[model samples]
Target: MIRNTILLAAGAAALFLSGCGEPRAYGKVDKTPYEIRECNKELYRGIDTDPEKHIDKIVVHKKKRELAMYKKGKLIYACKVSLGKNGDKGDKVQAGDYRTPEGSYRIVRKKCDPRLYKSLMISYPNAEDKARARANGVKPGGYITIHGQPKWNADGHADRFTLAHDWTEGCMAVSNKAIDALWIAVKNGVKIDIYP
Candidate 1:
């Protein structure tokens, strides 16, 4: 009787600790969540944006850590993203603030950096950004982008970690393969809207 009582109590405690009676999940995700234990193309297939899709708008939900692509007004593709340290807090106010700016922006340029793979530069510090910064006596920062993970992380490590946290300096980031597809699907003048 004593052993049975102890086992039941232990099970209850375990359930309580797991929160909502379910274990927490981790690692990379695509259309579905799965365990991506390490960097191996053989082990974990990368998430991709369809190149042929006519992507017109890119929407970012900072708190969700997701970037969704749209055609006309319909959702077409989405991929995991990492953002600046203060990405989920509020809009960026100044240079070197380490916060991603909020509101509508456009892809003004595309850049190549061997380390970051490829990038679509967003026109941050738009008129609104400038006004807000001016009112606060600050400098609205510029040169933000939606880009790929660092080359080292891209090779295989990102799937295990990048989506789990914020690590950028006011930029949004995706996996290399995702960027490869996005690089082709999007062009200068595409719209990008970011939200907290």
Candidate 2:
């Protein structure tokens, strides 16, 4: 009888701990992965071909939800993107909310987002972000990146690029395909300027 009670307790504990989505706790997530081929296909569809393909600089505008790729001084590619809501301000992203940040950043690491389709991790809330946040009265939250969509959400699946209002938690969001291309076009240490 004692053994049975212990087993039941353990089982119950395991059940209670398991949350929706992945095993990630309420506020802990490292990376999420999804198929790259589809993402790549979707990203190129909307890209402007008029611009040449020698990417030298990239800029993401949160308010505009637009990404501009430049080679030297000439524009090579321009694609619509999704940014944060409430207008990107200082650093420190709110939990489960949508709002892209505005600042200069770099692609530190490239990883697959298991939760989203795919993602290119952008280093946000850097020293400057923290400093500004500290100077202000708000906290400088972390976990900012350029990623794709989460799993199993079909509402906006058809029109990922057309939606308005910044809708990311202090992270820039582009189509999975765009990110995949970015993974190849935009190299590490490339400067990405995100603006409001």
lDDT for residue 120 in candidate 1, whole number 0-100: 82
Supply the global lDDT for candidate 2.
Answer: 0.56
Q: Estimate the lDDT of model 1.
A: 0.69
Candidate 2's TM-score reads: 0.63
lDDT of 2 by residue, 1-196 (tens): 9997875566444322321122243365442245545445545564312233436678976656688877777776777776554445643443333456667887665554445555556676688866776777566665667665544332334343324435554556566566556655765566788776
- Tell me the deviation in Å of residue 16 in model 2: 24
Lowest summed lDDT across 10 adjacent residues in model 1 is found at 15-24
Measured against the true structure, the TM-scores of the candidates, in listed sequence, are: 0.72, 0.63
lDDT of each: 0.69, 0.56
* lDDT of each residue in 47-159, candidate 1, tens digit only: 22234665899999987888998988998778898888667778888987778888999988766553455678898879999999999998887778887765445464435
